[model samples]
Target: MTAAASDINFCFPVRELESERVKLTPFIPDLHADLYFQGSAAYPELYDFIPWEAFTDTSDFVKKVIEGCVRPDTGIALYAVIDKTPTGTNPSKPTSANFAGIMGYTNTSPANLSTEISYALILPPFQRTHVTTNAIGLLLQYALDSPPHGLGLRRVQWKANRLNTKSINAVQRLGFKLEAILRYDRIFVGSKTNAANGERERAGDPRPGTVGTDTALLALCWDDWESERARVLQAMDRRS
Candidate 1:
């Protein structure tokens, strides 16, 4: 049986199995308040990583995420990573969660077998930790365990701005093979001017400027993921 067929309980409304050190829960409404306030305060460094040019208010960002979960075409599957706290005065307190580490496929254009691993964000505190690695492992498990698409998924893709070295390193460590770089596929603020136009266009607006920059695409096949997982687990065991 395919991974999908064996993993029926992996669907939405399902609280994904908590990692040995973390819990993966579906995003909730009130998290907006905590995440917007505490997250921004705690992990200000994250502003440089993910796109947040459009979030003006807490409610606006929350609403946008909610709409994505409910929408069909551009909607996404989301999860909040709750770090395990030791038994203490506030054992129930959540230490960290990826504010926008939204994981899900987009443009399953090739029917059941092919899907792209799209957007994900990790708040600063969670970086360099096992949270993202295991969270993604869970996501991959869900995808592979589900029917029709199980194991048949030819690729699990990760695309990011070439400047995002942290993301690049993390995905690489997770065993994703670095693929080709598409030149000038993405435009950026620094190089937003076309050769003909002397002035640089605004960041969000579409212009003829090529930026001469491209998104770096990385990919992991089932074998790659399994190998990576084994390596990660082995490293964790050695550390323990």
Candidate 2:
């Protein structure tokens, strides 16, 4: 029998999730400075993919966090990814965790027992590390585990810009299968400036100067998770 939305206790206000290398904490307004600084200072390339580049300022980040990320109805639960590894040479000394990036679930649909993973933003240094792999594994575990452990979701979806080969490759490695390409799926406002010359030239006729991007859809359904979960956890355990 399919569990109704009411039957599942969705983690509200985002709960804390931990892995060996990192910690995921619910987004709070007080994190505005940390999030802004980590995102802006580490790499300029972050602005290329993330649409919220304009929110580098603490005030804007706070406003956006309140209005978009933390809002209960938005169906987007944000988490601040923090690095838990010890930094200084002193092994016994306690070191504070550093904010590594942001990631979360979006377009959550409890009624359908499905959710979309979105807003993966790992800092450049944290890239290629097990941080992302473990983050994803943890999220998958939470979304797929049965009641008393997780949301018991039937499906978890991942969508990336078709041009984002890095993102596609990452998900593919993590066990999400390619589903389909959504043609001209999203219209990014002011994308013209960022679009390549060829892309701009090809924007002919109907929407001359507009820039649209195709979306690549991928998913790991319940059955797939059941089959792959052990292998995935084994890989994560090795990394952890």
Candidate 3:
């Protein structure tokens, strides 16, 4: 049986956001977990900036990421990215290569009308292509476009490991402004497989890994959307 979004207890209304270039659907573990795992297993470097590793197997992925982290109850909802832009220049139709990558919302707060774009991982084949730009632009539009077309959220944020220059640059390119740096953001449990590197835990500390990591915080408030939307679209339109 193909599992539904509810299987992971997704919090939102479960809308599929898309564009001429990409599609973002609620991630269903039973259907997507295996594909995501297989693709990522061969590319561990892709996860170097996150808190978790490339997952040993499908079961490990389902148990740790799907069940443990990205659940409605946990305030994190994931989506699967699908590439629709046919191969070739200036393609005008949908070819949908399937499973381009993954992205999600974290720390969502309807009351405050805020959310953070997190867990973005574009597979090796799709990186540096239209998939990333369109996927992010769709999410921005969905979160900031106001009622009748979007969640009308007041704010959307992007967080990354402070040491991840690539990630920091990517989000900033998408319209999020660097707000501040969070000191001692998280503990790496003395392991650096997922993060850039780490400093030893302080004296008398027991964690045994990097004492903690610094986080780069960035955001795009609703006020910035009117201008950023057009700018983001312009970026998506670039052929190069």
What is the C-alpha local distance difference test score of each model? 0.52, 0.68, 0.78
Query: How high is each candidate's TM-score?
Result: 0.67, 0.81, 0.88
Judged by lDDT against the true structure, how good is candidate 3?
Answer: 0.78
lDDT of 3 by residue, 1-240 (tens): 233736646555657786776778778776677878877888988866676766889999989977777763656778887777655632222123467778988888888889988889989899888888888888898889988898899999998889888878987887789999898787665357446335655687765545477899999999999888899988877788
Across residues 135-160, which tens digit of lDDT does each residue of candidate 2 receive?
Answer: 88888888887777778899999998
Relative to the true structure, candidate 2 reaches a TM of: 0.81
Clash pairs for candidate 1? 3-144, 3-145, 3-146, 4-144, 4-145, 4-146, 4-147, 5-146, 5-147, 101-121
With a 3 Å backbone cut-off (N, CA, C), the pairs that clash in candidate 3 are: 190-209
Model 1 is weakest, by summed lDDT over 10 consecutive residues, at 1-10
**All candidates: CA RMSD (Å):** 6.8, 5.9, 3.6
Model 3 poorest 10 in a row by lDDT = 88-97
* TM-score of predicted structure 3: 0.88
* Cα lDDT of model 1 by residue, 98-182, tens digit: 3423344554434445455554655556556666676666666555443443444656777866666777887787677889765
Sort every candidate by TM-score, greatest first.
Answer: 3, 2, 1
